[model samples]
Target chain A: MDNQTISPRQFMFLVILFSVGSSILIVPTPLAANAKQDAWISISISVAIGLLLVVLYNHIATLMKGQTFVQATIAVFGNWFGRVLLFFYLSFLYILASLVLRNIGDFMTTQIIPETPLQFTHILFLIVVIWGAYLGLEAIGRSSEMFMPWVVLLVFFFTITLSPQIKMENLQPVLGNGIVPVVDTSTFVIGTPLLEMVTFLMIIPYVKDGKTKKRAWILGTFIGGAILTLITLLCILILGSDLTALNTYPSYKLAQKINIAGFLEGLEIIIAIIWMITIFFKMVVLYYSTTVGIAQFLTMEDHRPLLLPLGMGMVVLSIIAYPDVAYFETFINETWFPFAITHGLIIPLIVWIGLLFKSKKQNKTQQEPS
Target chain B: MWSMISIIVLALGIFLLEFPKLYKKNRKKEAWFFTIFLLSFTIISVLESLEVELPNPLDLIQTFYKMIGF
Candidate 1:
């Protein structure tokens, strides 16, 4: 594969965008349902844990020494076993890309344009995602840099406009339940956009400068988690835990609550725009990783050729990803956390352990030869 | 029927757009890989357009996790 490098700054922006991704819209609902008024605390705890996860990912990247995650697996595990393990990893990445695509389709169809067929939305969004993937990581990174300011500004305005609606009573009885629920909710939070940072292992090696790569990864995650926490806190404060938990898209509803003296009523489109931009980057990152993973797996020269076909496949997979919204919710609440942990934590931990053994063996051989 | 036709046309369009470049470069391996992926995805798209009851991979994951009591 030819070299494509993105500066650590651009890498940071991508991390921030990807971390914020679809979580901004949907995370509040589950968090509020589980943790009630303490949902923000749940997110805060997850952010701290997420930082530690980033450190683990950085250690894996340091060991990789410029190899993509796909290549690293093969180097660490030998060809056949690595490829077997990689098949599972690649499937997870591919399914995740489709799932993200399906999310856009689901949101747009249900919320914005109810009349549009879900497949049409998927195809339309997939076209842009495919284009971004074909342009490669450098392009994806540059675009994230360009779009980061708008995301930040929209999120800031979103929080500021809705501040007046916040009821202190909404957050009363902070620990009314217990710490267990808070910790439990935090695990769910960690499962999502946090653990999914494993995908960044594919892109981290492409980032120039080792120290900045680590710094950018952690900083980007911090900012992203902060944005999510603020949004979740706003959801609880403005809409109250019950309504926030009940609604599928509380953050969007929070945006709609921005009346601004009755003149600015329907700025929910701001939420839509923010979600579109952030999810677009998120899907692009996931789609890029899937394509690159497949290309590297097959030992192909360029990943570009696989983009269009996979894009089509993703549309179909997404359509069938969840039969309905209820199933999606159940999958998220129950299955997603363990599944994510397996791929995001356990497998990488095994790879890290393998690296240690390999280094130790190399040291022993060198000493014996001397 | 129209959905099926559209799916096929879309696949063919992608093929036309990408195949020549791969062919020109004589990257035979990539060309073959692309053809296989395009063919398989095209077939799946057709099946999906037909509303065939294809199995969902996520069900398998859920089942496996449930079996393991996670």
Candidate 2:
């Protein structure tokens, strides 16, 4: 497992890319719908909460220093229960990956390439993801390092180019409706993307230097969350809260609004490119983790064989995942918050407690022998 | 019909490319998993492309949500 180690810097880029993921294009609309003018504040709160989750995930990673999340689960619980839990966790990851695939597929069909069928878009994306995962984490890590700089530059480009449309009055009356909406929005924001850092636990063991592991996790999460917050602020500023909330892809629309003396009139291509790259990274991370985790759980020597079949399953799952965009939105709005909390927060919390007791017992036994 | 044939051809191409290695490695269980998964996906894609109605996975979650009164 340690045969393929990635540098801390690459790890950080992966985290940033993973956190940005599919959430970048779509997250702001929900934030604006929930928090209105206070969307930025909601995102800020999510960042804070996200950092806290990073800490908790780091603690669990530290407790079982060299084990993947699946290994840790099996170590904490006996094999039978652990296998059951691992199965459930892996299932959750696969479902999430499929949904993400569906997201980009939906984005392409509805927003960019309406004439192209959704399955083609999905199959094309999955092909890249399958190949990336086949190359394994090291390649994915290096790819992130190479691409993250451009992603950052593009983000800044959007921020600066769209500056003319930003209205200070749009963000006026902050907390005028009190902090309820802000808090409400924060839960959705944090639960959806921030706490999804739980998935990173599976990759933590591959970091070369244990000392820098926690720092990379925290820094990556914070940087990613900050970018999200900045984008949320930009959405609110440029489009105003009402319009931002109304649009499906607020950031994409915001990109369309970028008119730098008519030179960059149609910048949605740039936004689409950003989304494709980030979602590719995101899906690869999730897909890699899912395939590798399944291989490990099943005691298979190679995860590559699982990729194509599982990738196919994912395409089908993505199709069946939602009947339409409206149902998808309803899932995000209603069920996803609790679902994310249960998997991301509650399960990890239990495992952490179990780890604490297991460590304590080990310490006591070691002391008695001494 | 054309899309369905293309999907089947694609599945067969991928199967031939991938399965030999797994067979040489003596990974029978994995090979079987791959075979079944690929076959099912091909069928689903063909059915979907043909506009045949199929059960959706989303409704399961929706049912769970309803049960929980969410």
The whole-model lDDT of each prediction reads: 0.91, 0.86
Q: Which residue segments of model 2 deviate by more than 4 Å?
A: B39-53
lDDT of 2 by residue, B12-53 (tens): 888998899999989988787778778887787778778787
Give the alpha carbon lDDT tens digit for every residue of A1-370 in model 1: 5588999999999999998889987799999998999999999999999999999999988888788989988988999989988898889898888888888788898899999999989888988888888888889889988999999999889888888877999998988998999998999889989999999988988899988889999999999999999989999999999999999999888888898887979999999999999999999999898889999999998899999998888888999989999999999899999999999998889888877787778789999989
Candidate with top DockQ is 1
Which stretches of candidate 1 lie above 4 Å from their native place? A364-370
Across A1-370, the per-residue lDDT of candidate 2 in tens digits comes to: 4368888899899899888888897789888887889999988988898898889899999997688888888889978988887776887788889989998998889898899978889989999999999998899999998899999999989888888777999999989789998998888878778877788888989988988878998999999989888888988998899999999998898888888776758987888888889889999999999988988887777788778878777887788777778888888888887777778888888788888999999999999988
- Top lDDT: which candidate number? 1
What interface root-mean-square deviation (Å) does model 2 yield? Answer: 1.9
DockQ of 1: 0.92
The true-versus-predicted C-alpha distance at residue A287 of model 1, in Å, is 0.5
Model 2: how far is A178 from its true place, Å?
0.9
What DockQ results do all the predictions give, each relative to the true complex? 0.92, 0.54
